[model samples]
Target: MSRTLIITNDFPPRSGGIESFVHELARRRPEGSVVVYCSSPAGSDDAADPHFDLRQPFPVVRDAARVLLPSPRVAARARSIAALEDCDSVLYGAAAPLGLLAGGLRGRVRRQVALTHGHETGWSALPGASTALRRIGDTTDTVTYLGRYTRRLLSRALSPAAAVRMRRLAPGVDVERFRPGAGGGEIRARHGLGGRPVVVCVSRLVPRKGQDTLIRAWPRVLADVPDAALLVVGDGPYGPRLRSAAAGMESVVFTGPVPRAELPAHHDAGDVFAMPCRTRRGGLDVEGLGMVYLEASATGLPVVAGDSGGAPDAVLEGETGRVVDGSRPGPVARALIGLLRDPDRAAQMGARGREWVARTWSWEHTAERLDGLLGAPGRADA
Candidate 1:
């Protein structure tokens, strides 16, 4: 392949799972081999990574929310960039938005790739959005799902032929950044949690993230281990409600939103990591391969994640962490208390997690895999 153009509705200095994912992908690609058409922040003061700009040309930065009356300007801009750069492959960060925008131009690109994380298959609620996504899946050369759970769901939603072309890519972790045995003592000291087994929930406080469930289960954990602490490290729209639920509870501390840069130490301060992601009673929206679980594990922390969604693929049960019914107080509390009780066991698990991540989940590995797909792809089928 000559070059690649990654068109995305996600980018930095905007913060979210997708933004981080896109940045990782862009950063890992071989220098000067890719161009990006993404949401404008490359235009803002926050987006001052000049070295990245020198490598991956930032051609178009459009308001992702603004859709044309009929045609998508984002897609049009990406096509124009691909033409100018003579790109051989095109990558869309998400199957919705950018992928939907590229629906009509699928045939124009040689290797059209769309990545799906979760929920967007049916959660968009936009007129004709589902149809557009189907077109995206069927027409794109490969539809990359974040994990088996997402691939399974999306495969069911499209034609069998299109489903056969589906691929799965688990998001990667920066092992160098979030390694085991880092200097996490300062965070612990600052929080006054010296030597207390901390259960950290380092995600946005959304209902889907299941922070509330963790809060409800805390009392039971405290009953089992009175000195244990729950460090809720993120903030979202559910802030008021979560604070209300944890009100008057001395063990529960909400640190609001911590920057992504400062997250590793917070993970270091914890003995066990948790995010009991829960879906609404009858909805498909839930965790789509929880990357934070991998981050926690990379920091040499034991994990406790929900059994639902693509999260299971990211975590190895009975090895690095435990997967339980996070929606329920009993399971969540039991999982936390069990890990907190035996520091030796938890430390072993964390060590295993770090080792496993170093072997299997590095950003370099994911980048190499993607580069192969976009590059030589030597197999006859490829």
Candidate 2:
């Protein structure tokens, strides 16, 4: 069987939406058919988790650098790996600077595919970065986008042919792992949230993710539903700011980055899931699809999504949940309050959301799509 070189900066034991997406897709590929070439996880030098690579089914080659760029040395190493492994294709985990390596790997690799997430949307707007993005689109056989919002912006930066070739490859949820009754009781009991109407937001505590907005809106939600508790999960640079935003609120709890295995239970603990994400830096910083919304939906929780970029794409409006203006505390508060106040309505929406996720956002479906894409012939074959 022909093999593929998975070239990426994003991979586990670093955690994020893009990292998870890439790792999931690569792991799902046929055994021995994939070989990963990724940079070392963010800190701790080359000595970082020695068993991370050993645990993988396929070979995982780690670069010494903490972050891999398309610099001459990095590109040279990628090309050498592709050649050494006899890889028929090259898969770039995040398109942008790393995808720039596609130009160097062209004739050597039969197929080259680059996956883009939220950050690429920012790159599409800048002058120099936009040109580089166009080049990446030009060199790679395909450039996959997360949603319509990203596609629309990226299309402007890509050549007509590249734009025409752009395909939707959004993240997917694991139905079995994230389904209803996935152990929310323990999470609630641990957090001292006994019988309270809980609203959970699972994401990196960040400015754009609107955790601050949710914090600001918590007071209004409490005013309407006094028993309601706000659960903020995950940690980031914005944690301090978010904590400050929630000061003096006893009902507000921060889990501060739980293990990945515990995330599903965190979602399960919430009666309603909300992330009032807003686009910042003009349109540059935005949500690509808000996979957490889909994950929340899969866990049978009614979502309150922000109307930023492609985040609205994850919701079915009245059928699943409300899409609120993430910037303002009033609309976000009202939305959360409305959902918290009505148990029957929220349950109905949650049920509908789970159904929608099972039908449209399963990891099986995404893996199949990626399998077909990888199997498709490229320019070299043509």
Cα lDDT of candidate 2 equals: 0.90
What is candidate 1's lDDT per residue for 1-382, written digit by digit as tens? 4677887767766678987888788777776777776654544424555344444444444444523222555556666777788777888888775666555565666787778877664543344665666777777777777776776667666667777777665578888789765667988888888988799989987888889999999999999899999999988899999999999998898889787788888888788999998766464567778989999999999999987677888788999999988779889999999999988999999999999998988887788767766654323221
Superposed model 1: Cα runs more than 4 Å off: 41-72, 121-130, 376-382
TM per model?
Answer: 0.90, 0.96
lDDT, candidate 2, 281-312, per-residue tens: 99888899899999999999999999999999
**lDDT comparing candidate 1 with the true structure:** 0.77
User: Which residue pairs in candidate 2 collide?
Assistant: none
lDDT for 365 in candidate 2 is 86
lDDT of each: 0.77, 0.90
RMSD values for the candidates in order, in angstroms, are 3.3, 2.6
> Candidate 2, residue 48: CA error in Å?
7.6
